[model samples]
Target: MCSWMVSSYFGSILYSEMPFNVEIKAKVSNASQLAEKASQLSQSEGTVIHQQDTFFNCSLGRLKLRDLMDGNGQLIFYERPDCGGPKLSNYSISNTPDPEGLRAVLADALGVKGKVKKERRLFLVGQTRVHLDTVEGLGHFMELEVVLKEDQSLEEGEVIARSLMKDLGVREDSLVTGAYMDLLLEAQG
Candidate 1:
């Protein structure tokens, strides 16, 4: 069941301290090539992350707990439009010291919606974070998260996103509309 729930739980997320996230996501046919291209533009070694994101049922917003193989975990809540283009995602992430305990708590409290497992290759390009993902049930995908500075405007973020899109060879038609959890739910049906 594909769902986007909006909840009053937004206040529970650490929105006051976190920066606004401007981002875009696209399905990549050639993730390796795109990673190579991103690497060429930015001289940085990509970090490989094996992650599992477990979503929970909420009343108003999307909430998920992301557990990384590196032992770091986070509980994330975000409210963003499901548009197939560049969009500003209002989100908050709180680091978890006990991911296993929290996962069990959230599962028993809200009920688990779905889970998404992926191996992500992350690269940094100036203000943007590039992710080349190979999902377990899905496939290859690329996501760009442009972290906006305190003084930066949304338009500026869009400009940066567009430039990176062109550089990374991401096409408008390849953009996806919802979260990976949504896709996973749809695939199940």
Candidate 2:
């Protein structure tokens, strides 16, 4: 198995623009042929998710597992379900102190507010995860994913992301172009 600590933030959108997010993790590669074998893991699975409400986190630290850093800020994303379109809502514990306290510290500094939601998941892949979600009276969603190709160059990572999105039948129209965290907030008010 290959690995590169991966981290990113799912942010809220404002005026149909960008969202607020901050996270950092090494994108570890998990064996090469994995992407070519994504279909094999697409079995119908299920589970119940849990989410801790969003809070202002402003701390700095590092992971005891890999080479993750908090050099910059990103919007931390809560776990989301994987379904017809990326899970619009699901269980997630943002501000993870992942070896590097980037999320907690940045979230507070950015000063953006986020809400939390949870539900039963219905997907899984080997050690990967799959879940189902419904944004409280907003919409339903699903998302399935394998790990990122490790140590791949920035260009390679972008290619993997776009290619996987296409192979999985993600629609250009349905794609939100931003984190559901921002979408939910927009729809809520």
User: Per-prediction TM-score, please?
Assistant: 0.89, 0.42
**Model 1 whole-model lDDT (C-alpha atoms):** 0.83
lDDT of 2: 0.36
lDDT of 2 by residue, 1-189 (tens): 011222222233212222211111111133123333443445443444543334342232111111113332223333322222222221222233442354355455654356445343444554334334454544554444333333334344334444545544444455442344545666777
Candidate RMSDs in Å, in order, are 4.5, 13.1
Candidate 1, residue 160: lDDT: 91
Q: Lowest-lDDT window of 10 residues in candidate 2?
A: 19-28
Distance from true location, Cα of 116 in model 2, Å: 2.4
Q: Residue 153, candidate 2: how far off, in angstroms?
A: 2.4
